[model samples]
Target: MATLLHQITIDAPASRIWEMLTSRLGLQAWWDGTVSIAGGDCWRLSSDDLESPVTLKVVEEEPDKSLEWLCVQGDPDWENTLVLWTLEKAKRGFTIRLEHRDWRLSEIDLAAENTRWGERLMKLRLQCHHNDDLPVNDDDLSVWT
Candidate 1:
C-alpha cells in the first residue's frame, strides 16, 4: 500500500480557508457539488458532469484547520478512500495539505491526482484572494464549510 501526499500554500488566511472547508457552497466549489456533510452519513458525492451517485462519509472535522472524509466507505481501492485536508498557519499565508492515504495502483495515478489538485489549490487561492466564488475548476473544490 502506498500513500499519496500533496501540499499547497494558499495566499488566504486560515480562518478564511476554514469557512470554505465547512460550508456547503464552499465544499461544492472545489470538492464537487455532491456533498452533504451536515446531512449525515452516506452523503451523496456525484459530480454535476458525471452520471454516478457517490457515497462518502465525514469521518472527522476540526475547526478552521482540518476535515477528513472516507470515500466509498473508506475503501482505498474504491477510489474515494481517506481524504484529509489540513490547514497550517504561516507567516504570510497558510499551507493546505491534502492527503489520500491508500494503496495506489500506480505512481502515475498518484502524480496525476496531485497535479490536478495542485492546479485546484492554486485556483482556490486565486478565488479566495479575489473574494470571489467562481472557482472555474471542474471539481469545484468548495462544497461545504
Candidate 2:
C-alpha cells in the first residue's frame, strides 16, 4: 500500500477551516458536485456529471485539530482508503496537512491522484481565502478518469 500526502497553508483559522470540513454546504463549495450528510457521521457525495455515489464515513474527528474518513464505498479504486486532514497553527494562519493512504493502484494512477489532491487542496484554500466557491479548472491533470 502506498500513501499520498499534501500540505498547504491557508489564511484562515483552524476553527473556520474545521467548519468547512464538517459541514455539507461548505463541502459543496470545494468538493465536486453535491454533498449531503447521510447521518451518523456519514456523507453521501455525488456529482451530477458523474455516476458513482461516494460513501465517506467519518472514522475520527478532533474538532479543529483533525478529521479522518474511510471510504467505505464508491469507486473501486478508492474503496478502503483513508483520508485525513490535520490542521495546525502556522505563522500566517493554519497549515492543512492531507493524507491519502492505502493506495493499491498503478504508479501512473498514483501520480494522477496526487495531482488531483493538489488541485482539490488549492480549491479549498481559495474558498477559505477569497471566498471563491468555484471548482479548480486544471485542464492538464484530470482526476475524473
Highest TM-score against the true fold, candidate: 2
Which lDDT tens digits does candidate 1 get at residues 1-145?
6666778777777777876665555655666446654244445555543345555667787777888877764223445567788988877788889877764558776666566567667766765676664444443333342
Model 2: per-residue Cα lDDT over 23-111, one tens digit each: 76567668877887666677878764334777889988888899899989887777899999999999999999999999998999899
**Models, CA RMSD each:** 5.4, 8.0
Residue 117 in model 1: shift from native, Å? Answer: 2.1
Model 1 CA deviation exceeding 4 Å by range: 32-38, 41-43, 48-53, 73-80, 132-145
Candidate 2 wrong stretches, greater than 4 Å: 47-51, 131-145
- Candidate 1 lDDT at 138 equals 45
**Model 2, position 129: C-alpha lDDT score:** 80
Number of clashing pairs, model 1? 21
- Model 1 RMSD in Å is 5.4
Per-candidate TM equals 0.71, 0.84
Candidate 1 global lDDT = 0.64
